[model samples]
Target: MIDVLAPAEAIHAAPELGAVYLSAFGAPGYDEEPARAEEFATEQIPLHSQRDDFKLVVARDAGKLTGFAYGFTGHRGQWWSDRVAAAVSPELADEWIGGHFEVVELAVVVEAQRQGVGAELMAALMTDLPNRKALLTTFADDRPAPRLYRRMGWKVLVPDLGWDSALYGLNLGVPLGH
Candidate 1:
């Protein structure tokens, strides 16, 4: 089962969850790698989430965390393309992490991969949404993540290698994408 959780509570599992995120993304892709500092990345998440636009969803099965998804509304200095970012983002950039419903993170435990946990988490994402779309990003083909998003009807709008993550849009209240 999956449930939307608060950042405060979600942070409690950070060390464990962080380990997982770091492990998967630590060395993803063949010739590309993140250029940002790990400390900065780690700190930005919990801190950025303090904004009102930030929301996190956690999935647990029998008391064990299987997966989680997180995102916020608008963010400042949109890196990829302000126009494209605004189109797919949950909220305006000035709204910061909490302004929009941009899913910054989503992961299922290694042992739980290939299960329906991820899909369940994503389903939970749209349960209360009023927006027509939402943005989610992940390493381009680093794993099955991008493919899964595509399978769910998410389409890539901004192709940014510098972002090191592929940006996707989900039509929340509309028919699945083509």
Candidate 2:
């Protein structure tokens, strides 16, 4: 089942989560380096957990991690938000940058793919967010992540924003479950 993780729980699960991340993103196209997973667990997750409004959701089967999604409230001056804001037009930046929830990572182990784990993780992570909007970036292809986001009503605001990726936005002011 998918469940929300408190910051402490997430921190505790970092090692296993790193393994899951390595397995998931190691898929054919991503070519993610093995050490990146270690950094994600040791550096990124812990740092992000300190952000305001941080939220994380994980799915486990038989006590093994299958999938997870996490995000936090975004604000001006943060590196990611600032970088994205600089890449897009002022109007687009103003509409979607700060005051939004930034979906940092969503990964499902290869064995768990196409079984609704990603969708469930996203639904649980995004639901009940106090922010009026949310944003994420994914490769600009017809891949599972992009398709899942589009299927859930996330709109592509900027194509090829950087690294051949696209910026996606969701209107939380409207109802979810799309």
Candidate 3:
């Protein structure tokens, strides 16, 4: 089952969350730098959980973590928001970045992929969110992450941001790609 966890609860589950993150994102060079990946997950998960508008959804099966999704409300001064703001036009920045929810991370264990776990985590995290829109970035290559976002109605706001990353956005109240 998937459940929304408060910041404290999420923080307490940081180890499991970090494991899941490492399992999902650790590949190739990451395999050679496991400590770096683990360190990033350790630091980021708890820190993001502390944000006021932070939201985290975790999928558990028989008491084991299977997947997770997390994000926070976007504001002007945020590093990600500022970077995206500079990349997009003023109008688009206002429409998508200003007061939007930034989906910082979403990952599922390899064994849990293709079972709708990611989608469920995403839906649960985004549900009832007060933000009018949401934004996320993912590798621009042929990855399941981008496919899932497209299937869920996210549109490419920036197809390629020069680092093999693409920015995607979704208007909460509208149809996909609108």
Candidate 4:
């Protein structure tokens, strides 16, 4: 089963989360991703722990941690992104960095890769999200992610364009009785 975990103060006070993340992605030689992940886990995670715009969702099978997905809002002035802050909608581009839901990270363990855990996590995240539109990035040739997003009726804007990364999106309506 998958559940969206509330980021508590305890979890944010240690490096275990980053350890797990590094284990999943593998720490290569000093590179951009490692440095970036380091900054994200340390610098931003604590903020996320306290912000309404951020969430961390985890997937467990038989009580063991298998994967997680993290998301937060994007706003206009501080729309923090490595790429251009293009809007999923017409106004998203010009919006504040912290006002739109943006998926910051997602991953599944190797043993759990084909088990639909990612989909389940996404569904649960969608169930808990505070908005209808979400912005996210994934590898262009990612065998299953893009395909699954497409199957789920997500809109794909800004094609690969031969970039190192590709972005995909979904809209989660914040509705009552979720």
Query: Which number leads on lDDT?
Result: 2
lDDT of 2 by residue, 1-178 (tens): 9889999999999998898899899778987999999999999989998999999999999999998999999999999999899899999999889999999999999999999999899989988999999999998887989999998889899988867889999999766556
On TM-score, who's better, 1 or 4?
Answer: 4
Tens-place lDDT digits, model 3, residues 74-163: 889888889988877888887787688899989888788889999898878878988889999998887888999998889889888777
- Whole-model lDDT values for every prediction: 0.62, 0.92, 0.84, 0.62
lDDT of 2: 0.92
Evaluate model 1: give its lDDT: 0.62
In model 3, which runs have C-alpha deviations exceeding 4 angstroms? 28-32, 175-178
User: Candidate 2 clashing pairs?
Assistant: none
Could you tell me every candidate's TM-score relative to the true structure? 0.70, 0.97, 0.91, 0.73
Q: How accurate is candidate 4 locally (lDDT)?
A: 0.62
> For model 1, where is the 10-residue window of minimal lDDT?
28-37
The residue ranges of model 1 lying beyond 4 angstroms of the native Cα positions read: 26-42, 78-100, 160-164, 175-178
Model 4 agreement with the true structure over 1-178: per-residue lDDT tens digits: 7666667731543254564466556633213366655765787687666655667788767876777777776655443452446423445444423455777666666567778887777766666566657777666675677776676656666566255456665656633222
> 92, model 4: CA deviation in Å?
6.7
Tell me how far the alpha carbon of residue 110 in candidate 4 is from the true structure, in angstroms, after superposition.
1.4
lDDT by residue for model 1 (65-131), tens: 6667776665445543364445444553333222345776776766777887777777676567645
Q: Least lDDT summed over 10 consecutive residues: which range in candidate 4?
A: 87-96
Top candidate (TM-score): 2
